[model samples]
Target chain A: MVTRPPVIAEWLVRQTAPADMREALLGDLCEEFVLRGSPGGRRWYWKQALVSAAQWVPASLLLLLPGYLLPLWLLDRLWALLLSSIPLKEDAVRAWPMLAINLVVACLLGAAVRLPSGALVLGAAVLILAASVRLPLDYCCLFLVLPALASKWPARKVKRV
Target chain B: MKEYLGEFEQLVMLALLRLGDSAYGMSVRREIEARTGRDIAIGAVYATLDRLEGKGMVASKTGEATEDRGGRAKRMFLPTAAGLSALQASREAVARMSQGLELEGLVW
Candidate 1:
């Protein structure tokens, strides 16, 4: 009988994988989980999930910066001007709009970053910082794992014959 | 100069060649582990495959859902003609690079 894989690992994959890829990728993980078929295998699965995340997440974010930074920076300045004019009295409430922008940007970052937990957390922090300053996070950049972030790319033709 | 496959990409492709028609993410990972004694993450494998697919070096098909995988379908992979050609080119490049090297005493 196949034992259940670790919850956190599964959750990590679900959180980051592209919708088009989720089912198949999860199936692959589960298939492996069954093949190893032991408690140690569950640990093995967790290690795989975390390790992959560790390697890819920050790397993707960093790799894309050269291509993204210029545009994002300029746009951010314009956004700051827009936000500044609507200033609230308190820093706390002022922070809310940034936080809101950060969270939305963070979620969008999550959608594109197929790297696991560590990457997810790091991506969120980076986006939050960027968004707080009215900067943009480039969700479209595909530095290393180009395919993971290119689910919506019209050019990616996956022929299944 | 021809593009060289990354070490892991070459390994995954070689694994696909061995697995033949049954190649999917799970078997490919196990095959590599068995042969190379390296524990690779499934995500890493898929990421590479996805990139390869993007590059038109690999192709995949989604198979019927299986109970063992909790009703999730498998994404089976196979090397494309270009993929095989690239692999061979990479292998030849490695051989060409090592052709005249004198390595008899390099290792202790």
Candidate 2:
């Protein structure tokens, strides 16, 4: 790594965008980072990272909202129906199926929202694992069912030749 | 009617348009910085470019990786038809709206 960006900032950008875009964006940032390799270059890099995250993260969340809501509404209704019909105990046996359902819904919502699965997985894992010490399975399902919340390039469309 | 772009969006599109064939992520950022003298984050620019592309206002293609960028390809941005039209329209709208403003003492 002759000239590299801050590792964490690069990681964050990688997680924010699609895989295909990561290299280009990181390269751009690194090029600038190298160019600004004066006394405050590291500070400048961090400033750019924080400001950029501030600008994008909220907007990306807004963009993902519509795609997320429809799936969530449908999933919630289905979960309700399942709960009413099947009054199973709150154990791993019941939890596993719900978790699986959440994962599927999460993936679908991820695709619908144009968020990569890697981001969705990373976000949910953090939310679930970090809070697992104090949270129960059903509670953790909330995080699991969430769509990926980051900016991404438009999904490719198919055109008939 | 479609919504008009914010100030930053217009600047970005203008940069891409101005850059022509050379409009990649870093170049666009530099264009904005040099022209406006306002420091901007490259991530923020990429994020907004991503959004514009989402709206079909801007499009991108991957060019060959260059040695200077650590073997990473450049994601070049170009304005779509809709983007150019939006930018033109937005400029015209602003000109129309500010046609009679008393700006004799304000910052240019």
Candidate 3:
């Protein structure tokens, strides 16, 4: 009986890896996994895969910055315009517009980038923004959840491979 | 001014020189680990290789797929003449820095 590396761990590495290097990288990991043997091999594989995936995060987050920041700035301007026309005395009600705009922009950016790390960064940014505006903890989570879901949006262009 | 190899880059290029034809990612990584006893990340290995290739210090080709590797082709790498020069330059620089230092048993 042949033992296999953990499937989900392999899938995560494949999904997160840059396209050009994917084949060779996965092949190396697979070969090393076999040589390392079972149980401990799985752990080692997971550790390597996770570390590799993490290296992509800083680049992905940097790529996402302009996409996230510009829209957020525009949304802030629109929210200011709306606040002038709509008067809300309660602090809770005042926080709602800020939270809503943050969620909307983060989701849009997350969908546009289509990278898992992009989604995570945008989601975390939204959560932080929501919390700053004093939204309830339950509502703050929505700021995180929506962008992650929106990250699965349909691709605008089909990849050649 | 001539560019010199960093410590890890020198190690990698030397490994390539030692490995000759069989120098691919896994083999190079294992060679470094065996000699240095350092736990090197595969991603770091590839990233360095890519950078070295970009600088024309290294070249690579795709080798045949193998069953042990789940039918994924290996990327074989070899040092260029430029790579050898850079490695030599780095070694000379280190030697110059250490010249006439009366430090015995400094190496751990």
Best of the candidates, DockQ: 1
lDDT of 1 by residue, B1-97 (tens): 5666988999999999999999988889889999999978888888888878878899998887887687899988999998898899999988999
Q: Supply fnat for every model shown.
A: 0.74, 0.59, 0.53
RMSD in Å for all candidates: 6.6, 5.2, 5.8
Query: For model 3, how does the per-residue alpha-carbon lDDT over A13-77 read when each residue is reduced to its tens digit?
Result: 76555545667988999899988888778988898888877876456456545555456556767
TM-score result, candidate 2: 0.72
Better of 1 and 2 by DockQ: 1
Q: Write the per-residue lDDT of candidate 1 for residues A1-161, one digit (tens) a residue.
A: 54787889887776455444568888888877887887877887788778766655556556445333443444446666778788577654543234335334443554454322233444454555556666324432211123233333322245664
Model 2 chain A lDDT-worst window of ten: A152-161
Per-residue lDDT of B1-108 in model 3, one digit per residue for the tens? 788999999999999999999988889899999999999878778868877887889888888788878989998898888888999999999999999997877785
Model 3, runs deviating above 4 Å: A67-161, B105-108
Would you list the C-alpha lDDT of every candidate in the order shown? Answer: 0.68, 0.68, 0.75
Per-model chain A TM: 0.50, 0.61, 0.56
Q: Residue A115 of candidate 1: its Cα lDDT?
A: 25
How do all models score by TM-score? Answer: 0.71, 0.72, 0.67
lDDT, candidate 2, at B17:
90
Q: Which of the CAPRI classes, incorrect, acceptable, medium or high, describes model 1?
A: medium
Query: For model 2, which pairs clash?
Result: none
At residue A148, what lDDT does model 1 achieve? 36
